[model samples]
Target: MNRTLYDLAGADPALRFSPFCWRTRMALAHKDLPVETIPWRFTEKERIAFSGQGLVPVLVDGERVLHDSWAIAEYLEETYPHCPSLFGGPEAQAVTRFVNAWTDAVLHPWVGRLVVRDILDVIRPEDRGYFRESREKRFGVTLEAFVAERETVLPEFRRALQPVRLVLRAQPFLAGEAPAYADYIVFGAFMWARGASAFRLLESDDPVHAWRERMLDLFDGLARRSPGHEV
Candidate 1:
């Protein structure tokens, strides 16, 4: 409905594929909301840093600027209320919030560590040592030590998700039979830290893997576009 914001953000700003960015892009694509993308470099810190809280995927909506994925999701939901509700239903909104929060708190950190383990191959060779070293500094351990620590955290994540398995059977999306804001949020986080990072921890024939495919299918254009093509 709002074409001006998309018009201004016509270029893909960031070179990296962030899950949060992917989620917002997919959200817009799903609803057929025409928003343009501004691909930003990490070096362009001043502009986006001030607005997006030092992050990518900041939506320039005409005069209004949206920061954070949650805020963006809420904006889209409110802006396009009729287009296949992202919240799915009134009750499911709470579920979406929980799942999104869960991904941030539990899943993301470990995924980040796992990603840093093999950063040497992924990033520029010059940045490799720093990337690997940052994980050590953050986790207070080497890759081997971090992996052991990850095992401890991952089981809890896997277990916490245990209760949701049953609900998932009936409701393909996290909120219910349909997808919701939370599904997009969690899906984006996972897609970024795991999918984009291509972390080994995420590589499995697990339910989460299955869940990823299911969530993407809930939307239209995003599901069709290969990861990291347009938005």
Candidate 2:
């Protein structure tokens, strides 16, 4: 099958950083599917205009075109049932929905506050204006102002992760012993931070940090091999 993923990238082109795109990338990897990833920038909406939407992680798998990370995951699960399950079973898939929602609603906002400013440094200069204007209009502040108090709010962000920490304390992954779509949903946020900033979001001793390390090591360090900061 010819699989292509229009993934969000930075100025370097190799620097893929969108949290949603990471989710899809990790999902494709989890399914052991090989893909050709195209570097997509914010200003290059025309590149993906055929997908009928602007945002990427737009996957063209065979004759099917899909978008939205969670929707893409479900599509992969159903279309490739014989492949390793992205969601272990129907019951697990049902619960994974909550993880997906929490990551999108709570985790992403917190992470954005921490690293959205740094993203300006990584994206192409042409895209920076659009990124800044859009994000600042949404945030009602400049990128620097939005993340200025990250140090002060760091504890709040860590505290918000208690639910995830509690779970990781019991299992190797959010999806249980082995990673599934649930793990990827959360891991994608960290990947965004990794690709965009040098700031550390988790302490070395933190269980969440440990889980991220394991996640990075998965699939022969697929994520770790990507261009990103060590943190």
Candidate 3:
């Protein structure tokens, strides 16, 4: 198909998982666009080099080439205005940016510390060295050292989710009655952890967990059907 997405995969090609990629996937689904996702591994940077940087979630919509999940989401919204709205309006779009930034800056990193080690075990063997080298450089610490105290710090990570819990307590979604780009932005991080590790990030009774269940059930169980941990 002309619409293609280079999605990050584990040793099993079916195991697609990357918070950023998941955002694009959900955006495409939100826009009712069909996409052919190509499984990509860490060391396979050359495969997506045409995008001008190393990353998955690269969108090739016919001749238009795009990278970055947020950019892709905007493109989809603008390109397919006839489709269901991903962002409700300009104000919502602007607000969604805050959600996107918080996710990329705060939630992603926190979840990474919890699941980064598990990722190494699932990635292809050949990609392990590259993953370790790159991650260590970015984190400035060995993976083992970085995640050594994950259990001890679990409470702190959950506490960081208070903002989301607060929102869900009042509305069914971060964007209000229905899911929107903002919801997808936050859910991507959870999908990342769910895909990589079986660790329980949210308590079963937590409002966040209830919201996650609602998200997973969206688009007829699209995220839930993906190969990943039940969490």
Largest TM-score belongs to which candidate? Answer: 2
Backbone clashes in model 3, listed as residue pairs: none
| Candidate 2: residue 198 Cα off by (Å) | 0.4
Residues 1-231, model 1: lDDT tens digits: 333221111123233445667677767766767775665533345667547475666777767777677787788788778986767656666557777777778656746644545333434455446546766788788856665565566666556556446566666766665665666766765555432344344435666667776765654535435433211
Evaluate all candidate structures by whole-model CA lDDT and list the values in order: 0.58, 0.95, 0.92
Using alpha carbons, what is the TM-score of model 1? Answer: 0.71
lDDT of 2 by residue, 1-231 (tens): 899999999999899999999999999999999999999999999999999989988999999999999889999999889999999888999999999999989999999999999999999889899999999999999999999999999999999999999999999999888999999999999999999999889988899999999999999999999999987
Model 1 lDDT at residue 89: 59
Better of 2 and 3 by TM-score: 2
The list of candidate 1 runs beyond 4 A from truth reads 1-16, 49-52, 89-91, 119-138, 141-157, 197-205, 218-224, 227-231
List residue ranges in candidate 3 displaced over 4 A. none
- RMSD in Å for all candidates: 5.1, 0.7, 0.9
Name the lDDT value of residue 209 in candidate 3: 97
Q: Which residue pairs in candidate 2 collide?
A: none
Instruction: Evaluate model 2: give its lDDT.
Output: 0.95
Candidate 3, after superposition: displacement of residue 12 in Å?
A: 0.3
Best by lDDT: 2
